[model samples]
Target: MSTTRHELLTAFDLLLAPERFKDYGPNGLQVEGRTTIRKIVSGVTASRALIEAAIHADADAIFVHHGLFWRGQDGRVTGWMRQRLGLLLGDDVNLFAYHLPLDAHPELGNNAQLGLQLGLVAHAGSAGRFGEQEIGFLGAPEDGATFTSGKKLAAHVERVLKRPVTLIEGQRPIKNVAWCTGGAQGYFEAAIAAGADAFITGEISEPQAHYARETGVSFLACGHHATERYGAPAVAAHVAAQLGLAHEFIDIDNPA
Candidate 1:
């Protein structure tokens, strides 16, 4: 049994609690299509490639972490933006997106999911106030894995995310960690204040490297797309299972 577009939106609103976040873009139903959804496609970003792939897959809707119409971007629908919106409209496919909510969700969030994948236990208490939203997560090595070196942790992240990870190593062993997926390098300072031995994020800036070196807190830039790839798929799978609709996660490669 397929679910209506409204039903899907309500489900996600309840699950991710979009109103709780002040995100860059809208969190649900960016583009409207058919009233009922039968097939859903999930991706990290709602790029032209991903949109085309979803069209090929005969998807009724496309769910993404990075949706169009960011905070500072021009509101005009021209050029590439127009092309992308046109494709979805022409194909009659809906677009759904969740940004900060996907990262902050306790159970299926990007940060939480990444921590579990890397054999770390989520510890909300570890990290203090971070930004307008507590999207980042703090974690510690799982029981029995008392210690993890910076090199080993980076290697494990690289292996799991299937991408090369850059590390700014610290002197101490990595006993506790803080992470937030996708271009969240600025959170490194918060991680240090939280007493995290290491901080992991999708991308890093010039200042972050200098901060890591001086602060003695290890930092990892683990590929923005790679780190955020899990959350949308997880959300789509859950939505599909809940609504009894078919789901597919289409991966479009982006090194950044």
Candidate 2:
């Protein structure tokens, strides 16, 4: 089975709502490939390496969290940028990147999917002032299950990502927590201000270390790639289901 590029892009545009965000790169389609797609690949970034992998996999379309054409970027396509764009263009592969929009969706967004991974039910219409929706959320387990401590929560995260978690300073067991998807260390204040007991996000910058320590909040540094892979797959699965297109999610793993 196949779908036209225009048709697929239309479905995805409505699903992601790229207009809601001021993104670093072009949100929807970056490269126009074949008009019809039979297979789609999803990843965290359109890095040269990942793009190559998608090409090798014979993907017609690639979906990602970080796309090309970032904010404060040069208009000229040169060096790494030039090489990446060349690869996609030369191969006739279409690229679709979703940043904040993927992070904001209630059921299909990166933040929401991350929360669901850890058993969170997000509140409706709780997007922040930055138009950043809440990714981490508060929820009790379906069977009244519990995570005994910050250490335990960190351990669970480690188990899920298969990476060692960098535990930030915090105390006690937790059942109520909050989180955001992607590079959202800046949203820690939002989570804390929301009265959350703990917070989790994908990548953490240097300054966030001091912020977490001073705020008396526990932080966990799960690799960015590991944290974000879920949302796109979730979206792809739904899109494939909705439009009845054949979908295969290829994981081009990166230990970022």
Best by lDDT: 1
Tens-place lDDT per residue, model 2, 44-104, is 7789988998899898898887888777887898999999989999999999888878877
Clashing pairs in 2: 24-70, 136-179
Error of 1 at 64 (Å): 0.5
Compose the digit string of candidate 1's lDDT tens values, residues 165-233.
999988778887888889999888888887788898999999988988898888999989888888888
Clashes of each: 0, 2
Q: Candidate 1, residue 133: CA error in Å?
A: 1.5
Candidate 2's C-alpha lDDT?
A: 0.75
Residue range with the least summed lDDT across 10 consecutive positions in model 1: 123-132
